[model samples]
Target: MFIEHPSQALNSLFRDKPYQGVNPEEAKFLFIGLDANYEAQIDAKPIFAKLREYHKDGAAFWRSHQVHHPFLLPQYSGDGRFYHRSFARIGFTPEHANQVSFIELLHLPTVGRSSLVPADLNEEHLSKLSQIVLAGTAQHIFVPQAVARLMHATGRFAWLLKRPSEQFGPLGILYRQQAKTVYSHLHFSVYGKFEARKINEATAIRSLISAGI
Candidate 1:
């Protein structure tokens, strides 16, 4: 399951008065996404440190892993080869790397310095790259596509199609179309007023378990 903030959220889940129906032990995997440049923020250090600790523990406990967009990682050329290597270092087996059960980080380039929206990239190119990422990291690839198509057919894509700056929600919907079925129990905490608070990891995990991920 995707745990937006497994560290803090987990604590909250374990501490909140009455126990809920969720069982944490049932979680076999945890996928985490972190902002690479989070350390730059003076106030974000403590939270980031906690997240790193949680990441290490989760990786050991559930063989969990992480995926970061190019913008989040250190300086590196935006090349497919670089991505392949990065994925390997994150513990993706060669075979798994070519399948749909793995996690992926999608990156988009902005057109100008003042722009918050991403550049209008070629859809075909994005699709091709997305296909590669899915094939290498997914176990149930068809489900995500089906979800996206269903959403698209029903006009849900209309809302998702808006640029990040234009809409406060759906910033990560593109990746939703490529997740494996097992990872469908995923949710992203984008930069917005509503999600202003950093995600608490434990809480996210409990929520996922409750949701039957």
Candidate 2:
């Protein structure tokens, strides 16, 4: 498996740019989803599927990949190169995924639209994922629309959503006290077959920064 989760300290999983406009060293928010689908494949494996020992959380192997492509912002007409330049005009760097902590609700791989996970996804799996998700100091968090609701329904991670969050129709804001993290839900997708709201920089950044992260 050709993975970039090198033991190289600077290029460690935590420092790897796994999303657009994310720089873990500088950003204070995290945007998580089901998994990644875009990037130069290794032996035809989705970047997230190539698990390496260096990955602190194999379930989140997507973070181990250097993601420079705009896999989430399809509304940009797949023209992030020029669209992101406008973001630079506003003083926010674009196409960097280091700052935004990257993780996935399911540390599994989506093959041709089929998401495959461990046959037996038990508490242990969730526990490991929870640890990785909480370990980050990022104050702002964004999860796919169904992720937060499912986490809330699971009766797990109540500690992360101890406070009543504000629900805005299809969106909501979950709060945790330990790090004062705010979790926002969004519908993100780049697949033409799947209809989902495209992720936007303005909304995501504003929510993250306004959360006081």
Candidate 3:
């Protein structure tokens, strides 16, 4: 696959600006989402600019960002509970959430509740995301089921999807690769109510732990 420079690719992911999480360079895991949800009209340029400024401080960026935007913190009373639980299941330490990066397939915020409107990204966007996925430092990548479906349907990401996947519990799928691992689970909002999958989730969690991810 033809690869573009990191900054150039990331620019596409965030609609012509490179936006990434705190300590992306050192992160061991990546939690990806479809897009941001907000009820107000937003201009993301300044937000990305602010993030770039805070991200320069590896020691303080995570906490500082959390202070300013408590909703982004995993411990907050939000969809992040899904991430917190999954991180624990993987035997990952929560105090080190800075070691995990958050990536969005689309950076634009949707009004009210988030939905799978686009379903998939265009070629230009997919090429950019592919560059990051192929070369980034995060060894473990997690995405919602909707995003996973998008990847599976897009030809640009076919190289990764072609690999056989292991069924992870009742509503998740896991793919192991030489350099990284990809796991797709139910959307965070629905995850809490999906009680029927609990037993299988435990077994899958143990399998994931054994995989050394």
Best by TM-score: 3
Give the Cα lDDT of each candidate.
0.29, 0.43, 0.51
User: What TM-score would candidate 1 get against the native?
Assistant: 0.25
**Model 3 lDDT tens row, 172-194:** 44566587767665554455556
lDDT of 1 by residue, 7-28 (tens): 3433343233111111212212
Model 3 ranges with Cα > 4 A deviation: 1-20, 23-26, 41-61, 64-69, 72-95, 113-122, 162-164, 168-174, 191-193, 196-212
What TM-scores do the predictions have?
Answer: 0.25, 0.50, 0.59
Given candidate 3, what's the lDDT at residue 44?
36
How many angstroms is residue 100 displaced in model 2 relative to the true structure, after the best TM-score fit?
1.6
Q: Residues 1-213, candidate 2, lDDT per residue (tens digit)?
A: 122322233233333433223333234556665543322332233323233322443223224333223322333233224433332222223333344445555443322343333332346546755654567556566665556665665566665563437653334567665663555543443335432323343454555444444
Instruction: Kindly report which residue stretches of model 2 are placed more than 4 angstroms away from their true locations once superposed.
Output: 1-27, 38-67, 70-97, 115-122, 133-135, 160-164, 167-171, 190-201, 207-212
Instruction: Report how far off residue 81 is in candidate 3 (Å).
Output: 8.4
Ranking by lDDT: 3, 2, 1
